[model samples]
Target: MTTTRAHGEAARDDGRSAGRPSGRMLASYAAGSVGTGAFSTLPGLVLAYYLTDSIGVAAAVATVLVLVPKVIDVLAYPLIGALSDRASHRTGYRTG
Candidate 1:
């Protein structure tokens, strides 16, 4: 014989009690995204201009300076992904 459970009971059986985010959690996540997006994007947009115009750096040099960090980020991401995968395998949690 088969038995059926309510929606909440079925979610709890799999250990994810809070199946969907609460309103407060969703609001907090939205606020965090706005703040983090502004902080991350503003510098990339302004840094090269500031270096070339205000600091009197040559345009080519400023471009290279701005680009080097991006290159490092490209290289580092794969390594970080691999590390996270390994950690997840060991701990059963996908956290670095």
Candidate 2:
């Protein structure tokens, strides 16, 4: 004979994926994204100000300095994503 269990009892059988992300995970992702954005933008903002005013560099040059690095950073994103996928697979987690 087979027995059936309620939803709560079934959830207790497996430790993962009872539902969507918890509040803690959502908060952590939000904070981490903000931190990373600050780290990336702070230097560019300072340099743009210094180059256009204190250093007497042209606005074009300042823009180039600010934008080129960002462009390069964008280009690397896909490769980094692929590398992360490979690492996950190596660690025995499927991308699916």
Candidate 3:
């Protein structure tokens, strides 16, 4: 059960090559996730607060206004990505 290693990849007794990410990658990924989470979250929070405080919109109404599009996006994006991938495969263009 020997595994071939890619060039410049360090081999390990654990059977994973350096091509597999290590702790640095995990830290980088964690940082990126935190940044993405904050990036995605702040706009909705600000919009909702603005609607309630500045626009005189009711809090419940503002909450729903802010929430529904996110709900729709959550529901629709997977189907859209699947369709996009299917179209790209049919056209034989991986990057499309």
Candidate 4:
């Protein structure tokens, strides 16, 4: 007799339950999200405050200074990733 497995049966062969992350994994993910949130938000807030209150920059100018880099980052990171991928392909990094 022969049998065929369905969608998630392969996962059980490795002792994992399909479609469900573990409690510890969930907690870790939550912590990572909190850390990522702080890192992404605090710098902008701190920079704007520093530029306006400490350095006496106008609010509008401070806003622009804080935001322009973020805009550049949003556009540049994907382009950089594409370039890195192309370079890696040319270099044959993992084609052994």
Candidate 5:
């Protein structure tokens, strides 16, 4: 089968123009994933380890410290998503 892309271009399910990302784009995406993963994971691991092991804080206290921000995020995300959706609806484009 075929699909019509923008500008009246015909797209097909064949491997040639099936919208698969180029190798360079895939490599860039992989690098981005690794960087993003390290940035997101390392801080939490280091912070928890530092708080408990180096600073001699209690485990429960360290857990709470880490969790409190996530609790706020859990609550805030829905509100933020709703606000962005509303803003987009009103303006016909995303606010940011």
Candidate 6:
């Protein structure tokens, strides 16, 4: 049996062209993930420790402050996608 490379896809050792990742795609994903993680996780970790040890704020209040922002992410993602869809842009690119 034999396989062949398809257009745009990279040819692999098996002779079939497997999908290749675009550098922009990877970079965008990496940047977004880092930003989101920093926004959501870093504050929670830092504030929780600060409130529990240094500030003397109640644990419950500290937990709520750290958590509510993260919970809002559930709605924020779809809202952002909806906004993006409605937005008019000069540049267009393939999603997949």
Please give the RMSD to the true structure for each candidate, in Å. Answer: 6.1, 5.6, 5.7, 7.2, 6.0, 6.2
Candidate 2 C-alpha lDDT tens digits along 1-59: 33347653432433346556667878998999999999989999999999999999999
TM-score (C-alpha) between model 5 and the true structure:
0.59
Pull out the clashing pairs in model 1. none
Against the true structure, what is each candidate's TM-score? Answer: 0.59, 0.68, 0.58, 0.54, 0.59, 0.54
Indicate the worst ten consecutive residues by lDDT in candidate 1.
8-17
lDDT of each: 0.78, 0.82, 0.84, 0.82, 0.83, 0.76
Q: Weakest 10 consecutive residues, lDDT, candidate 2?
A: 7-16
Q: Which stretches of candidate 1 lie above 4 Å from their native place?
A: 1-38
Ranked candidates (lDDT, high to low): 3, 5, 4, 2, 1, 6
Candidate with top lDDT is: 3
**Candidate 2 has what TM-score?**
0.68
Which residue ranges in model 5 land beyond 4 Å of their true spot? Answer: 1-38
Model 3, residue 63: what's the lDDT? 89
Report residue 47 deviation for candidate 6 (angstroms): 0.8
Higher-ranked by lDDT: 1 or 6: 1
Clashes of each: 0, 0, 0, 0, 0, 0
Angstrom error at residue 96, model 3: 12
> Model 6 over residues 1-96: C-alpha lDDT tens digits?
543567655544644344566677689999999998888687679989999889898999998988888788887989997777666353453353
Query: Judged by TM-score, which candidate is best?
Result: 2
Best-to-worst TM-score order = 2, 1, 5, 3, 4, 6
Task: Report the backbone clash tally of model 4.
Answer: 0
